[model samples]
Target: MAQLLKMENITKKFGEVTALNKISIELEAGEILSLCGENGSGKSTLMKVLCGIYPYGTYSGDIYFSNEKLTANHIKDTEDKGIAIIHQELALVKTMSVLENMFLGNEITQSVITDDNEMYLRCQTLLKQVQLDVDPHTIVGELGLGQQQLVEIAKALSKQVRLLILDEPTASLTEKETGILLNLIKDLKAHNIACIYISHKLNEVKAISDKICVIRDGEHIGTRRAEGMSEDDIITMMVGREITSLYPHEPHEIKGEVLRAENITAWHPVNTHIKRVDNASFSLHQGEILGIAGLVGSGRTELAQCLFGSYQGKSAGNIFMHGNPVKIKNCAQAIENKIVMVPEDRKKHGIIPIMGVGKNITLASLRQYCFSKQVINEPLEETIIHQSIAKLKVKTSSPELAIGRLSGGNQQKAILAKCLLLEPQVLILDEPTRGIDVGAKYEIYKLINQLAQEGMAIIVISSELPEVLGISDRVLVMHQGKIKADLINNNLTQEQVMEAALKE
Candidate 1:
């Protein structure tokens, strides 16, 4: 029960903005401390300061590890001291094998020769510790997101880490995968390996942490024993306000059918014989929010991609707008027909990372701001960009800031703004609230309801059944590339949806 790590008076700044303000934290051996906050809050910043990603002198903080003053100038320095960080985005090289990624920088060597056999044996042992039953020779890219996550942990174990830092580890994982990860952390705890767990999933935090720390903006709110803190208490401390409802539902009239699909089928891009989406058909009505519920690999996302014309695979379907059949061969054609989607993987497909927030928001509808000879009206474009930022409530210091620098929640909102610029008749959102905190999720749900109220035909695909039940007027349960049931959301329960999805 000795103190393993302590960070005191941590303060970091970017030019003029103070990212962390006199924050302090302490963790003991075998303890799990959950860091809770909204997007852009100082949780990650504080961790970065601790792990030496921000470097020693760049931030004013005193770190004590093993009751000794620790001033680490690089991430390597911390890694050498038994501290390892696994970011939300996995840092594995996809083209490489699992063993290669595990021993990427620090390979076992003997007499100026790389010791592959020694490393392979160690890799197998680490994988066994994490319960990831994959071959060491398997390509990291070929593994599922859940398994890849476990690989990251196994890699950390190979580093001989004593204090581990995990950032949004379950953001992209399935429910079963998340369960496995939670259990693995408990196992690690039993072995006296301390951990700092950062996630927006309050239920997981409540279930896992020994202590909970809340940070707001750049300052420390407080840290308390996890035993007595409810998710509501954590929310109040993090957002500095009371959130009465997690899902804000407003009554809105559902109008006539605006779009319909018939015999929609999609084939896997690489394995052409496999059907990613099979003969899925549904109708979307104006001012109605439709929710698609399914587990991972159930083909919900493939169906949305097929509708948006962004599916990489071969697809066949009849898409009708206002009862008239239309052809959407590509994303451009889909956009031209006034149907747009905010994709599931925001970091990959949603926004241009290197581009400014303004440019990314206007990228989808730049034609509207162009004049003769494709010359853009800078004044008009800037005006609309500012307006979109305001409308979406995107928290950026300036629109010219790179969209990549924004937090996950703000990045998501910016992407939503970008899609809205197209002024689509039908909007499809896939996993819209993934990796974002509860407060930001509430804002997103409110916006979705508002859009539905404004007579837009909306489709929402989500892994969380509670989210599907909370906002949708109707729910479509898909299992094994088929839409099993379509039911009106009249006081529907999660059990009902799961039963439908699992029905034979």
Candidate 2:
């Protein structure tokens, strides 16, 4: 295989912080290179540099495409060279139709005029190639996260991209959708289109990659054939140490019920008849982690919101704190009752982008740590924030940094630390480790174990079957706003959970 692109001596810095440290990388024609690294380890930075987001003077590097030194002045320059990037978050206008999104900037024309028919036909064929069954005329926004993702890929493909850059593409996708995307990636390779697969999902990386390159602390660790590398070896290279086991579990025996929900049902703010959450009833016990496993659009998130009193409009639910039933109408009421929740979509709900780390960490618990009769104690607040950051092992230069500036894993840790600050009797974590790296995931599990050991009831909702089975004392599989299976999860496997999840 001939070399397609090479980035030599890439070094990037932001003020006093160095993002990339003279990292060099090479890509071959039709190759699928998996870029493995921790969050903030410069995987995304290098990809951005390749795509010209950093521009010429912003960094020191030399890029060669097809043996010709390439100039990456802007995104258009990169795209002009048959390179396209599909980001971690899908960028598509929801109001527009699939065909429109596919040929957004580069539209089709016939007889020197814009041709909608030709573009529509091409969009249909592309959708078929991607195996997405949605109609080309359908609105992109109305589609689920998984479907929207397929549309994003279709849009990128329409650009005639040769080297496709995918960043955490499966972060929001379900098992079935992830499989579809993985297959699409394989199809791209067959078409002689090389791909740069960047993700925190080691399992998917091992499954789809032809070769893997390890990057740690902004430096190139090395590259090896995917077949020859073990997950342990890759993890060690990325984090600079061996992480033998990913899941860190603690034995917790439930002593008493900490939270109880009965006949919980909620409707959409506009669509009342649309049952977002059905008559769901569940319980969380002290010193136990109860995991909720379900696919996207299965009402798992809605249920968590309803319980947290974050749901708008009429929500009929009987929430009990330690067997004592109480009514929750807002976030304040829920917090007062010692019930706290971290939402599923961190970008959409969890972290405030403009808010500083210390402020976001203390957002939930501000009421409790008040000093001098309702006036917030700045000194005490600082002390708490520092303690939380250290206790969580959050990798940040200072607590004053914006929460958005941190890596996905570190942002998640900040959110977890916020929940801990609330000191809730029950913790509702929805997709707690979603889009985060493996090392961060183990830390989250450790945090959960520590909380449970101290008699805190933890309810975890996740799409990963192995994660649910590994962390929870009992697994509650939800399907279509209803509990499908409530298993003890002792000696349970991913196959068993999937069997139960798919069970009618």
Candidate 3:
């Protein structure tokens, strides 16, 4: 294998924001390089520069490929050079068939017309190379998140991509799915196709990457070989400091059952046999953190959705608050019942990107400050917004700022504040500290500890095994839409829980 791509002294700026500052990296043939950074820390800008989205002269950089200095004038020119980026948001069209999505914009056609059969056959061959086991004709939207991820890999495989870039490839995948994806990456490297994987999941980086590059505040810290480094060491390198503790899970003695899910079952929107959730029942205690661990499609997110009344229709479940049952049909009813859920897909369900921080924070709690005529009160809304911003430690210019303008960590904090506005007895955080920096993660952990200390029954569903192990009093492992094992903290290890998660 040879040095396939080299980026030298990459410097990019967007108005007042310097997205990248003198960043440099290399991607060798048949090896994976992982870029580690917080959300706003220059990784995307560097990638854009390479892929020609930033173009030449827009950024101060030189991209060399195949031993030639190249100027990528546009996205097409970059693709023509055999470089492809699989975005954090998987760029698969949901309603389209797998083959259609794979062949989109570059469909296989006969000398006379479009040849879909040829396309299907090609898609099948490519999908198998990536170890996907679904029909090429299957609609991508019908598949689970993990399956959709496989489809994304297949789509990338359609082209002769020499340097494939993937961002947060396993953010929504289960542990099993993540394993499969990592294997696929290894396979790609075996073919001498270099890869650049960007993620905040340090464990995955340690497992798959040959070298790890740390970027902070839009500057390259350094790149180190991944062969010898502890998780703490990587965290220190990425954040340029030692975090004595990743999570301050100070045990708060449980008082009583504050929230309970009794006989919960959520059906799939189309297929019925594979119930998204199957007879799932769990209880959250006051002043304690409950962790739900599962493979992808184990119904963790579905169960949270069902509890929050965000499920499609006819969810068979009963939620009890302080031992009294309640029916929550929608988000409003769930808020009325003092049950708040921070969804796993934060960008899709949790935060409003275009809305201001103040408005988004006060979105779910306007009833508490309604005027005499039942209209939302402006002064009261401002007061609540400021209080939430301060309480959550959200750093921004002001509450009037757009939520997207903040870092991923601060935006997560904003969502935490929004949930707190309802004074929820039970707080459901689904992958809450994802895609953020370690310092931000510790701050969030401290906040969760404080919430637990305040007697708030908290249910945390995360894909990171270490995080779940660190924070939970009790861990529930789910497989195939059922709770496989509910184990106490003292009785669990990463291996044991992973074994339970892989149960047949």
Candidate number of the best TM-score: 1
- Writing each residue's lDDT as its tens digit, candidate 1 over 1-504 gives 999999999999999999999999999999999999998888888988998899999988799999989899999999999999999989999999999999999999999899989989999999999999989999999999999999999989888899999999999999999999999999999999999999999999999999999999999999999999998899999888998888899888899999999999999999999998899999999999999999899999999988889999899989999999989989999998899999999999998899999999999888899885479989999999999999999999899999999988999999999999999999999999999998889999999999999999999999999899999999999999999999999999999999999989
Count of residue pairs whose backbone atoms collide, per candidate: 0, 0, 1
What TM-score do all the candidates reach, one by one? 0.98, 0.94, 0.90
Q: Which of the two, 1 or 3, has more lDDT? A: 1
lDDT of each structure? 0.94, 0.87, 0.86
Model 1: how far residue 394 lies from native, Å: 1.3
* Colliding pairs, model 1: none
lDDT tens per residue, model 3, 1-504: 688988899988878878788888887898899998766777887888899888888988788998888898898788888889988778888998888899888888789689988887899899889888889988899998888888877777788888899988887676778899899899899899899999888888999999998898889998889897777877887777888889786768789988889889988887765688889888888888999998667888889989889988457978898899988889888888888999877888888998999898988777778876578889888888888888888988888899978878999999999888888988999998887777789899999898999899889998787889888889999988898898999847999997987867
Q: Cα RMSD (Å) between model 3 and the true structure?
A: 2.8
Best-matching candidate per lDDT = 1
Off by over 4 Å in 1: none
- Clashing residue pairs for model 3: 174-296
* Candidate 2: residue 62 Cα off by (Å): 2.0
lDDT: worst 10-residue window of model 3: 365-374
